[model samples]
Target: MSGGVVTRGRERRDQQNGQNSKTTEQKRDEEQVQLAEANSLALTMRSGLQAISKEIRDLKTEMKKDLTTLKEQVTEDVKSEINDLK
Candidate 1:
């Protein structure tokens, strides 16, 4: 309700808790603050995820390079053994 609907049944309850209720302006301000905080947290999380994803990609590339190097080294060793046998 806009300011709080006052029904006969709720009259007493309203009277008692009226002071505890927030004004619409106060509620709006609080909601805006909460939204801003949520947006900030979402941005932070997104950036964190991006950083992790980049790290993973870099690691994969490095791993592939290392594996290729190891394979080449093994091939060279095998060729050297064949030459020795001949």
Candidate 2:
């Protein structure tokens, strides 16, 4: 009877160990998937930021051109008004 009890206890312990190992494997797989998704999201965000930076640079260039044109127009108007006064 004692031998039978020992054998049963060992069997139960083996079963529990197997269950724990399976759980650990499942958790590892889930972590890997999450890591991959995070990496993909980071890459997508970087690309979007790069695109925004380019757009901002283009806008700056356009604004500079508009300001130069306005300055030239103002200077010509001022000169015209002075000549009329003279």
User: Local distance difference test, per candidate?
Assistant: 0.89, 0.99
Report the number of clashing residue pairs per model.
Answer: 0, 0
* Displacement of the residue 50 alpha carbon in candidate 2, Å: 0.7
Candidate 1: worst-modelled 10 consecutive residues by lDDT: 1-10
TM-score of each: 0.66, 0.85
**Candidate 1, which segments miss by more than 4 Å at Cα?**
1-22
Which number leads on TM-score?
2
**Residue 30 miss distance in model 1 (angstroms):** 1.0
* Candidate 2 lDDT tens digits, 1-86: 99999999999999999999999999999999999999999999999999999999999999999999999999999999999999
Model 1 Cα lDDT, one tens digit per residue, 1-86: 54465565488778657755657667888999999999999999999999999999999999999999999999999999999999
